[model samples]
Target: MNRLGVQLGSLPWLVLVTGLCITGLWSHQQRSYRQLEHERVERDLAGAISQALTSRLQSTIGVLDAVVGLFDASSAVTRAEFHEFYMALNRRGDTLKGIQGIGYAAVVPNNNVEAFQQQVRASGQPDFTVKPAGTRALTTAILFLQPNDWRNQRALGFDMYSEITRRDAMQLAASTGEPTLSGPVRLLQENSIRPQVGALIYQAIYGQPDRAFNSGQDRRNRLRGWAYSPLRMDDLINGALATINNPALIGTSVLVYDSDRTKPNNLLFDNLNLAGSNKLTHPTWLDVTIANRTWVIGIQLDHRSLNPQGWSNALLLQALLGASLSVLASVITRQLISNHQAVRLALSKEQEVSKERALAGTVFDSSPLAIVVTDPNGVIVQVNQAFCQLTGYSELEAQGNKTNLLRSGRHDSNFYEQMWAAILNKGYWTGEIWNRHRNGQIIRHELSITAVLDPQKNVSNFVGLLRDVSERYAQQEQMRFLATHDQLTGLANRTLLIEELTRSLALARRQRHGVGLLFLDLNNFKPVNDRYGHSTGDALLTAVGQRLLSSVRESDTLCRQGGDEFVLLVPDAPELKQLVAMAHKLVQLLEQPFNELANGAGSIQVSASIGVARWPDHAHDADSLIEAADTAMYQAKHQGGDAIATASSNATL
Candidate 1:
């Protein structure tokens, strides 16, 4: 009964539960490993596909770079010269796999369009004209597209800049002098029967090839044409994947979208028709940014390896093995517990008697009262936990010492003599006494002593109990302080102000001197509080109170009259002139920015409108003096604040 005797009866329950937990944990770890391995595969396969697609698209930009270079080195490139250069580069065609073809467009000014057409016709294409072009401000005419295929011939003479998508890309290329990609578009060469989403990469070729262009504006000023390659999105993604040597993607389907969102219109390529399929599990998504365009690539790995059914038989076997172990463990534990039952019952009865004695000893040591027991001659014998705490002495330190070891020296010999006299005469003593703690602090205690007597009525030992009362006395003082002061500012409140004023006035009347009162109202304080929350406002008010304290005499009483208003009572003033000068000084100090609140509150600037009044000069008593000063403070506020207004005529200082 002392400690439930370890409840050896739960041996069976403990073993059974532990075995089951081990079984469940083992199964969980296996599944988690399988899941994690599958996710790793998905991530790697998807990442590789995305990287290959991005690399392939980036590779196609090199063809456009080659066209830009040809124009850069030449004074002029005729249609035949451009065709010859492009043919030499495209002979192998492996690097430019996804590009339909590369071409150059000529920039034609609207004012000189007719002249440009005539010049182009004169150069060999006598029938060439800018197609669908009429009074365009400017045009990039596709003058030469090769390998001169039927699709290439159809686009020649078309104004590429007339289209918004192409114009935006060409404009970007011209201004930035970088290869740029167009957003999703349909190429002009695409047939109606098999139209596909398309994009274009463009590189600007400036007319003043030998002239170095320093800025975008300068580049635009000398812009000649563009070297561009049109793209078929489906072919582009396929070409990118074909370049990847990673064999992990053998059973995977790669789908590429124009951007990150997976929508029908944005879908560029779906290799295995996986876009509309729901059977794919754990699809991995990747984003590839290529030439200022973003494409989202999704890869789905074969889920056959992830089929949990493949391991169902293994898990079933594990469950049966766990059940067998649990049954064997329970059977063995039951026999062991039964064998120990008789021996444990005997030990429990023997433990009960020893525990009772220990319990009694524990209660004595743990008592809240500082208890001490000593022989009739007063040699120390024992002390409790409370005694150690109250006097800062451990039981080991106090056991062999006399009771006088605690005497604080605050009481004279007569105090101890009286305490002993009462104890010996009446066999008891009770009184408040002072003792010195081990740490050299004086502690007050309410002490009581009684003599324990034998059958013959002779004293055998004395028992003393004491309770520490120092905290109770200190708390009384704290309560008094709280009642008379503002807790936040630690300044005297209105109650203390009245008391101090009454006493100061009586002295002033006998001494024939004046007392000054300044009532201050912080200008627009509500707005400040509203602007920066109450906590900051409270901090500002406390700072103001301390600032006023720093500039005042120690005898002066400063009080927070409530809100942002405060009152300072100067007991003995030199004159009305000095008092007003003090008021102005306070105003100046307050107007300076508060550095304490600068970290979060910014530069906080506060000003005070102070109303100054004097004893017998403004009014007779404390309340009347405060009222007169408050009225003058309002007058100061009306005069735009940050100034002093006194009750004395005009009241300006």
Candidate 2:
């Protein structure tokens, strides 16, 4: 009986020992699986965040590229033309803060400064002012040449070039032939409002005829002028923070810096700088370069602020699962425990594998943004449903094809080469691109592409994400029309006309060619408006705009400078005779009777006094060219309405 009792006791003890050993093995395996799962999650999270950041950067680059392309291609960019662009910027301002002003620079002749200054002063502001380059100077002024209520006449003569900092920045931009970012410098224009650095991105122009250089001179040899846009650092930091996916994790600290040493010591941007905080072992920094401007985006997430509940819940679940397994092991003897344990082990391993596969599948299938996978030669390999929706194409149709199936033909082979070069060197490329939809309509999309490298370090696949920007483009175009064009006549407004003239003048100087500027004032426009009411006057103006559009060559520009004043720019004219003949023909066209009217009052006859100025002959630069033609127009008007006058006889209006 004693031997039997001992045998029963040993059986339970032996079962307990076997149960504990099984539990230990299961726990060890579970831990290993969990660790692997955690690593995988971390990697996915990193990749997602990186992709988001890349998309944001690409969108910003696209906007900048559009602006640059417009500046490079168009003869003149008016406030109206920029209206759509400005609105687009404003709409996306949350994504890109800090952008302040966009402007162009034209060489003004030293000789014409006085006349220009007088005109500006007459218009209620100083004509010009100079600031010494590289100094800390803060002063703001406004000038105007036309009567407009919203005009900032105070900024007219403010010598921005005199400021040492602005000068240094401009010089740097000219030297680099690339957009250069300056350290935070105080903006005199916004001084009383808030301390802001003027981030200036400038493009150089050469051979302005208004300067000492003649048409034969190489303007490109010397920097003639520059176009610049200012960015505020504080605003940029705020914008970046707004774009962060996990805003809650952003905490209260952020810092932005320019990594370039040649630039100043100003922080690129700063929100709540926690430079001395103990929670931060090292600053988390992200380097972004767009349009040749480099910025170091830094973020600091406070450890204490992170929610501990997530980790706690995960631990609790782990413990519960372990306990459940142990209980099951204890209930079974060695035979049952071994069998059950084998089943449980297999199930756990299967679950872990399944979870990994699900994670990868979720990443591939559930992303909100469109993703396209292409093989090394730019042939499409696979595309997610998001891509299908974006491109209006099915998976089967896109697969096994070159990306050119969606090419809008808006960009040339050179453009593609440049894109490839960037990607090859940096492993990533981003920009705004126009691609054709399956239905053959052009679609503008902001795109981000990343090169996936194989173990051999060669690019094996490329993943691209695209966001449709057609609406944004439309909005921008609308804004531009509103700002630079006359609503009544649909012709170039004074601002736009002047910009065009200046651009043409520069071109004339470059080509050693002549340009004609014609200033025309309707002879009996006031009488007609007074007699026919304002509505009729508007109709007449619209008719006049149409006539002018139809009468001129494609290279010519016609504009209304308010009231009955009109200016025309004819480029590459050989002599003043051609301009005079065109002006005479225009006058005759206007003098002819018009039958279309709301009143239906038979017909109306109109005539105009015309003034002509020739580039390199009557005037040298934009201001002088306009002034001379304007003066001549007055002379023509003084000589009884229907006539023409040259700048040789400077008659004031």
Candidate 3:
């Protein structure tokens, strides 16, 4: 009786052991399967994001290229040209914000003698009533045919001989003879009311016979006026943002900065912060440099917002299948208990564990998330294929090496110290990191590191998971650019200018230094717009923006304060004379005739006014400084458009 009882106990014990083994194998298999599914999903998500961003960038580049081509073809720079160019752009009208305006600057005959002779011989008077080339309305200014009246339009006849800013831009263009994009600048004419102007500039090539001049001393080949176009905040930039495909998936923000003082705080564009679930939020930003402008584009998405229901359903279905399979196997084992039970059960559990491990390994290796395991010393013990792909290294090359092999050199030792400290304290750390690939290319990565503890609660190993974030960085850069830069001329927009001005004010107050502000209004830009159209106006604006950028010191700020007005912020000026000199230089540059085509025909002309104000001496704060400059600018305009006026003497506070 005792032996029979002992035998029963042993049988039950054996059965219990076999069940435990089978259950362990089943759990391992399920975990492996789930991990594989997660990895595949992550890879698909990463690929989708990359494709979306690439498409957006490519589209933007294409549009810019088309705009440049249009600027090169015409000299008239009119509305008709703008319409034609817009049609050529091929972007849907609802999608486009309209081709604004174009203009250019060039050298023309300055001889009053020749002008009078031509006027006497010609029909009554060459019609100087400038009208928008294609449209009857939107007239802005008139031109006089009389020789004396032509004085304002003279290129060489005037004393703009010493203007520095204009001369510099022209010189730069003449020397390089290549199309150059200028930093953001405010339009001079729009100084009175509007607070910003953005323009795009193109250098004119003038060797054509139609642009030939009679005087050997004529410097016609010198810097020609720029082909320019202006951009409005709600129009070009905002419109572009609204068109972003899957805006829910890709949250974007832009920041534009101007290295100037007079007009400092310019916020170009920002479309960040959206509400949604399942979105991957990308807080990382990247810098994109174009010409002299630097823009930051930031992107974010909520991972939870992206089809969470689908993932949940998949998980539920997987669990249900796993449970059903486990139950069926358990029942089968019980039924076959008497026939080869020991061998079948043992093999089944072992096979299941092996299959689970294989599945898990395969999933991990093919995952988009880079996975790496290291011993306590930080020497890599194992790396997945994704890790190899991210670092541009092969599995064989990465194993047994240190994680530092992929260091990009962008971060200092202190950075690593902080990272390690966080991981040690919290057991895990998550952040963005800069790393290098095998090809020496710097790459951004979203990284999570965990400290694996042993039975004694001592750190035994480290595991790191990384996802390449280069695309997200690029998107962030694009956002920053849209926010602070003028889309038209690529100058610092009003928002950026204000920020610079505020900073300049703080610096000036601390150093007790003087800052100067110059307000500019194009003397006859309106006539150019009316006669030639927006296309010509745009070309002119682009050229003007370039000229403004060239005229200032590297320390100064040039901004588009809207319409035909522009502002210059000169920090740490020694005296008012320096300010006057800059103002005069700007005036002189504008005095040069803008050579442009009319209805695809040969060249036409334009000019501008300048106003100067000094900080503390003229007024206080950004607003007052701007006001003083505006008052002086109008005074200069009243005295005759092609001149400069100082705020201290011209306006009463």
Give the number of the best model, judged by TM-score: 3
Q: Rate residue 25 of model 2 by lDDT.
A: 71
Leading candidate by lDDT: 1
Q: lDDT scores for all predictions?
A: 0.78, 0.63, 0.58
User: Which residue window of length 10 is worst by lDDT in model 1?
Assistant: 304-313
Clash number for candidate 2: 28
Model 3 TM-score, all chains together: 0.51
Q: Write the per-residue lDDT of candidate 2 for residues 85-138, one digit (tens) a residue.
A: 554454332333334444454444443544545654554333355322222332
What is the full ranking by lDDT, best candidate first?
A: 1, 2, 3
| Clashes by residue pair, model 1 | none
Shift of residue 24 alpha carbon in model 3, Å: 20
Q: What's the TM-score of each model vs. the native?
A: 0.45, 0.49, 0.51
Better of 2 and 3 by lDDT: 2
* Poorest 10 consecutive residues by lDDT, candidate 3: 142-151
